[model samples]
Target: MRDLDALDRRLIELLSREPRIGVLECSRRLGVARGTVQARLDRLQARGVIRGFGPDIDPAALGYTVTAFATLEIRQGRGRDVRAHLARIPEVLEMHTITGAGDMLCRIVARSNSDLQRVIDRVVDFDGIVRTSTVIALENPIPYRVLPLVTQDGKGLATPRDAARPQGEG
Candidate 1:
């Protein structure tokens, strides 16, 4: 957080809500100068305090009715290659290399169970993917939400990029 003051916290909260908000508008809302907002944003981004943000799309609205997570075990010496392979699959919305039983975890969406099967089977057929286990989600209790950087104690969990947690948001 680089000892972020209240103004910096306000800026991050505002940016998380709307990344494209103009600096002038942000300044007006925070009662700070546009240049000050710009400087804070630049520092935040440079120090990895704030990444990027965009819209959150609904899979159901997009006709993807099925959501699944696939746990994949890679062949020897092929973990990195397996991720690249899974990334090429259109259905794989998110991929993570977890520390649990699986080497890679993939989130996929499909229009139907058969479609989901096809997607997972494609991943299973990949060269480096040795085995796979899948958990088809019946419902998503919470979709996706970002973390609150500023804590209750008026402090932010300032972690470097390497220390940030994974997206195992179940």
Candidate 2:
């Protein structure tokens, strides 16, 4: 595949904002034929520039008012082994391994503080996890944004052309 062009970068940025935008509509907005947009989208997907897309659900609206981030220090040599244990807990919405003092950062949604306690208990109950420090989300300042790629000089790269955004993003 060729290097990512301006159109490809533009497409990525647009998709990040509106993943469910239609191909035809995107072509219309970009002043290009629908086929051109489709081809670019396909290439982007094939090259792993675009992954999957889905809806963004509000945890609070779904009866979960408590949001917390859990920084977990796992027991030595058992990081990946904890997936099955963590998967059983429903309140754990997302888990990511980060570089820092902690091995994993877990995003949890709960009904209340007590519910968050339950989730934390579940996390600590796993034999593989050593310690967990949780930080409650008071307010999400930026929320989620599928960021545009940055160049070596720190300029944001655009995605393909606008296809509405792309499809299936949060």
Candidate 3:
């Protein structure tokens, strides 16, 4: 993995705060040269550090209020087949082959509880899947974030508090 320095973190922080900002704007905000910002962005993308500037959509805003995680137990040697089956379902937001009691854990969203049941049924309809357990999320007290990870510089990791602090402060 490539390590990120303070400059990289600052550049990412600036772009993340204002995704609409262009390379010239980023250079201004970060107080760096335009070509430097462009080059860094290009390098970040080439190294798979920065994936894309895609819009972040909220499922609740899209009328899919119900969020649930389904743990699936599938027949041995059929993990790949079960994954391909789940990939076809639009409601399956994310899927991972996990350890412990379940072979796979899938994050799904639905319109309602009844609709969630329908989605679950579709997941279980696969021939390789033997069992499944699902738990619905009532509320998200803390949503997902990557800024904390971005705060890290060199060998040190930054805490959430550190991210809130001004840059260059120990």
User: Among these predicted structures, which one has the highest lDDT?
Assistant: 3
Per-residue CA lDDT of candidate 2, range 46-84, in tens? 987777777778989999999999999998889778877
Q: For candidate 3, list the clashing residue pairs, or say none.
A: none
What would the per-residue lDDT of candidate 3 be over residues 28-128, giving only the tens digit for each residue? 88889999999999999998888899997999999999999999999999988998999999999999889999999999999999999999999999899
Better of 2 and 3 by TM-score: 3
Q: What lDDT score goes with residue 162 in model 2?
A: 25
Each prediction's whole-model lDDT (CA): 0.77, 0.77, 0.87
**Backbone clashes per model, in order?**
0, 20, 0
Please state the error at residue 35 of candidate 3 in Å: 0.7
* Candidate 1 regions with alpha-carbon error over 4 angstroms: 154-170
Please provide, for model 1 over 29-131, each residue's C-alpha lDDT reduced to its tens digit, 9 standing for 90 to 100: 9998989988998988888877765576788789999999988888889987887887788888999888889888888999999988788788898789878
Worst 10 residues of 3 by lDDT: 161-170
Which candidate ranks first by TM-score, i.e. highest? 3
Candidates sorted on TM-score, descending: 3, 1, 2
* TM-scores vs. true structure, each candidate: 0.80, 0.78, 0.91
